[model samples]
Structure formats: C-alpha cells, structure tokens
Target: MRKIDLLFAEYGESHQNPTNKFIHWICVPLIFWFILGFISLIPSAHVAVLYYGLISVVSIAAIAVVSLYYLKLS
Candidate 1:
C-alpha cells in the first residue's frame, strides 16, 4: 500500500522466474565488476587514496547515488 512497497512489489513481479534469478546472480557481479573497472580508470584515482581495490572515492560516490535513489523511492 505504501509507495516503496508498491515499487518493490512491481520489481519483484518480473523476477518470479528461477532462470531469471539465476542469470541475475551471475550478471550482477559481472556488471558490478565492469563498473568498478570503469571507475578505477578515472584520472588520479590511485593517488593519495587511503583505500583498496573496488573501494575508491568513485565507488563511494556511486553508492551515495544509489542510496539517494532508494531514499527518494522510500
């Protein structure tokens, strides 16, 4: 009944298939890795960063963006 619940229910509707779920399990990580790889290529991405692989400032920025989207949805 709530807007966030409705959003989740709509999203869940398409994921009822087991094959789709399995494909997502594989593709999600691959896509995530691809995104991290892209972000890592940013100029000066390595200098003065107190972090490890896949945990750079750009990745944190991406997380913030996603969190903001969810916050708006909720």
Candidate 2:
C-alpha cells in the first residue's frame, strides 16, 4: 500500500469503536473550523517582504508555515 494509505489505516485502528469514531467525525471538523475562524480574527502585524516582493503579515505567514509543514510531511 502507499505510505499515506498505510498511515491512515494504522491511525484508523484506534477509532474502530463506533461511538469514538462518531465523535471524531462530528467534532474534528467543527474544532478545525472554529480554530481557523479564531485565527482569522487575529490582527496581523507586518512581518517581512518576499524576495520577489510581496509584503507578508503575521497571520498569513503563520498559515503559510503550517501549510508548508503539512506539505513536507505529505
């Protein structure tokens, strides 16, 4: 199996119980959306200028770093 699929299969083993699985399905996305919305409310401060040259601010930079980390893991 592919690496991502194998990883998911192993992770899925823990949530095999129906109640726990149901809780995760319901809560996880809600929690993610809430957190994203909370972060969006933060007032951004100027952080840096890109080499090619767009101005970067704190909130956008934070999201970019997180996105890059996930990309690296994948």
Candidate 3:
C-alpha cells in the first residue's frame, strides 16, 4: 500500500468504534480550530519592506508546522 493509504487505514483502525468515531468527528476539528485561535492570540510583527509580511504570528507558524508534518507523513 502507498503511504497515504497506509496512513488512512491506520486512522480508520482507531475510529472503528461508533462512539470514538462520533467524538472524533465532532471534537477533532473543534480542537484544531481552538488551538489555532489560541495561538492567534499572540501578536504579530511587521516586516517594514515586505508590507504584507506579518511575521511572528504564532498561529500561522503553527499551521505551517502542521502542514510540514502532514507532508512528511504523506
């Protein structure tokens, strides 16, 4: 099996129970959003020359790191 398929199959194994599936379906996205919002509470810094570079925004950094992790997994 491909890496993505294997990853998804492993994920499926964990969610086999109905109650576990229900809770994960409801809570997982909420938890992800909550973490993003929590990190966004921190202030961002301006990069004078770039005009659009709001650097040091913790939420964006967190998302970037998460994306990298997903990439590695895939």
Candidate 4:
C-alpha cells in the first residue's frame, strides 16, 4: 500500500506538466468509467451501478481538483 501510494505521488508529480495533466484529466475518468462499466457487467456488481457511478464521478472530480491544485503550485 505504501509503495502504491508512493507510485501515485510520483505520477502526480509528473502530471504537473500541463500536457501530461491534460492527458490525465481526460484519460483518467475514461479509464475509470470503462473499468466500472466492465465491473458492472458482473452479476453481483450490476445491482450497484448507481453507487459505482457516483463513486467514479466523485473520484474523478477529486483527482481533477488535486491535479489542478498541484499544477498551480508547481
């Protein structure tokens, strides 16, 4: 978990560059949406589509804000 967190921190640092940040802003949510959509195809997870959708939106928003904040700081 610690390693994963460190990796993400490094990734966030790289994304402070405007081009990389823009790419991430677009790709991240799309990747997450596809992931959730794939998971929702599972029988058990299908029932929780709304929950997953909300979480995905919130996560994307949070990431966007954080990325922008870091970009501004850098």
**Tens-digit lDDT track of model 4 for 1-74:** 57667888988787788988888889988987776566544444112255444234444454577689778755
Model 2 score (lDDT)? 0.73
Clashes of 1: 0
Error of 4 at 30 (Å): 0.7
Which candidate tops TM-score? 3
lDDT values for all models:
0.76, 0.73, 0.80, 0.65
TM-score result, candidate 2: 0.50
RMSD of each: 3.5, 7.2, 5.1, 9.1
TM for every model, in the order presented, reads: 0.60, 0.50, 0.62, 0.48
1 or 2, greater by TM-score: 1
Give the poorly placed runs of model 4, Cα more than 4 Å off. 1-5, 45-74
What TM-score quantifies how close candidate 1 is to the native fold? 0.60
What is the TM-score ranking, best to worst?
Answer: 3, 1, 2, 4
In candidate 4, which residue pairs get closer than 3 Å at backbone N, Cα or C atoms, i.e. clash? none
For all candidates, what are the clash counts?
Answer: 0, 0, 0, 0
Model 1 RMSD vs true structure: 3.5
Q: Candidate 4 local accuracy as lDDT?
A: 0.65
In terms of lDDT, the poorest run of 10 residues in model 3 is: 46-55
